[model samples]
Target: MANLYDLLAGGFPIDRDKPAFLLGDGSAVSYGELESGAAQVAGHLIARGVEPGDRVALQAEKSVEGVMTYLGVLKAGAVFLPLNAAYTPAEVDYFLGDAEPRLFLTDPAAFVAEARTAEPLAAAVPRADGDLASLIYTSGTTGRSKGAMLSHGNLAANAVALHEIWGFTPGDVLLHALPIFHVHGLFVALHCAFLSGAPMVWLPKFDDAQVLAGLARSTVMMGVPTFYTRLLANPGFSGEMAAHMRLFISGSAPLLESTFAEFEQRTGMRILERYGMSEAVIITSNPLTGERIPGSVGYPLPGVELRIGGGEATGVIEIRGPSVFSAYWRMPEKTAEEFTADGFFITGDVGRQDADGRVWISGRAKDLIISGGYNVYPKEIELVLDEMAGVTESAVVGVPHPDFGEGVVAVVIGAGDEAALIAACRAQLAPYKSPKRIVFVDDLPRNAMGKVQKNLLRERFGSLFMA
Candidate 1:
């Protein structure tokens, strides 16, 4: 049986009495309890007519029961599809309609309670390596969100690689504060802990005080750049709090170089930043025991093959790996279009690979700006804007221009003289590369994962150069 859960089950502590989750209230969920809870939930799914290969959708808040439900779905030989809890009714409607799951869980706690009455399933259902395990929807920055079909082999491969590369041991305790809806929290973070049979310190979401308190007991923490930034802002967080921690892994968004430097100054430890997407859970990661360079996502995993698509200094990223998803669920045309005939998936992320195979992402291919027939990469411009006086951070976008086909526009997060900012860019870049206009705001719009939504910025300022 190639069931992913079986692999996780095999990794559980030989003594099942060990804790699976260490709670803030001094309570703990034992590995034994987790196993039985999953059995009951699997039995409930079977009783509810959910068959092997059937889709089960979940859009609910983070909870212990939610994790149980996920494990149970796998045990029942069903495909698990997780939707963002923060999504609106209409947004949820689209996902549910598209996935067409046999069961949709709105309240995980209720389901857990109902499942307890059911008989526990004796064992996990058998599955092949290629059987679909989950459907993770993309961020939908430039188009409709596509459901990436990840298989048992895909999840297992990535989990095993991460568990080994990140060095998760039985004694490690993970401080897990991210939401379970996304890949960073659910697949990458949770999978590692489960694969190592290590316990996690669970929180409903990222809270400053809770995270600070949790740091005292955690051995490892995997979170987005925003988590680190918020911690830096809090006065209570200090190097001593994280002194005992072994690793801090960041992903899901770019870690600003300033944040990286500041964190090292405060904690005397460099963060391990990785690169990944929904299509492939995680492709490249900085070394756990080697050089963790700032702004670089580091090397590809052991079995993964990566290359720049256009053979240029900077181009779209393409990869072939076991961890890569099989296809987009029910979207044959879109699926075929995303992958090359040679079997590499075109990641649509513009980046470059160094001689040593280290990766540096510039921006999305779709986010590329064209002004006066010259190529303008937003990341290149954003880096320049970010260093200017009075600018905390910046998002560069291309808007309609009366003269140039498209005009460069900078949506900044702090106050600055527009002329001086534009002048600064012109001094460092070509005239066409400089922003035609600069707009200051309190903050840039970000998604649930802390990624700046460049599409929204383009829409908001699309009419900037029209007049």
Candidate 2:
């Protein structure tokens, strides 16, 4: 398929009457309904002057309409930008200012009303393989969010690779509870279903009781580490309940060895952990029909090239593949700097390959933290903490947590009350960005160049939450 939309919507050939999305309200959206709905929404977008290559930003609640809107963006040949629903108005403003989307969709009623009067497009807008498909914003070390430009080929290639590797079939039912803003949910989970024509048990959000109850109906599930931890704590979730399930995939953050082991012990099935980022939908995944090793993300997907940059046992991971994004939106120089001369995208993650070629991420080259499937930049938190009263300077690092893959910890060199500092952070940042623990220190260790040694801080407080 030349367009990513074709790759997704092409499932119509398999079985148009097949149920595509089984919603929480006991409504089943068939493939034919999804196609018609997406086409109508696309017609509305075209009526509003959305053209190919134009950005269409949506910051709305997760619902059947939300998914249809995403498909509509693609069907209209506009680049879809799904913003986090939890972002404050200020954050939304920043994204709108940067991306400058032609249409900003918010209310679901607007979409539904437009669809009612709209007509299906005679044909999907013509798009080239290299044309941009979506723009996913990821925070940089400098505190500014950079939009990753994912091309049509990038998404299609990854979807095809995952659909085959994960053994997805039309008979499978995916229990999808992940938010649609990120790649794990939007590109990975949704793409697999679209490619294989699989049905999805769609829940608005992850609820322990709801998920446990859905297990009997679902054959597969993809989630972050937190989902597994919460399910393990609930008595309703048991090995018997998951006995018929085909697979359990985890990504968007590292899965702790403890969670992996406990899940296997509780469910009698190992959780398959994978590695991916916004720049690339999925690069490595544990095998679907083989031995899954704990704490390793397993081998690279077919056609993906991965190598260590520094040549050490552990170093920055570089990747080159069709799935890798083309560039950063409107930042040519920054994009050029991120890729190597040989064309490998610098992943910024420090990892190593075992003797069997399984990739293991040790740490991040940049102090980017993934907490509860959300990316938390240390510089963002430090900037907030440094502005607080009685604070000389602050250093933030992510340490291992039993629940969140990594928990944010702020180490301060001045006399600030922990509760007050945390409250200040909670006011300025999102709940996920707020530091979980505060450690008051006399001084922060610095190197010869006067840079704060975050590695030293990580070493000092790695077990803060675990203890």
Write candidate 1's Cα lDDT for 1-467 as tens digits. 47898998889888899999989898999999999899999999999999999999999999999999999999999999999888999998999889999999989989989999999998899998899999999988777999999999999999999999999999899999999988899999888998889999999899998999899889999999999999999989999999999999999999988889989999999999999999899999999988999989999998999999876888999999899998998999998898999999999999999988899999999888889999999988888887777988889999889888899999998897999889889999999899999999898888889999989998999998885
lDDT of 2 by residue, 38-103 (tens): 888889889888889999999888877888899888989999998988788998999999999998
**Model 2 TM-score on a 0 to 1 scale:** 0.80
Model 1 weakest lDDT span, ten residues long: 383-392
| Best candidate according to TM-score | 1
TM-score for candidate 1, residues paired by index: 0.98
Q: What's the lDDT for residue 176 in model 1?
A: 96
Against the unseen true structure, what C-alpha lDDT does each candidate score? 0.92, 0.86
Model 2: pairs clashing at backbone N, Cα or C within 3 Å: none
Q: Any residue pairs clashing in model 1, and if so which?
A: none
Error of 1 at 28 (Å): 0.8
Give the residue spans of candidate 2 off by over 4 A. 139-142, 368-467
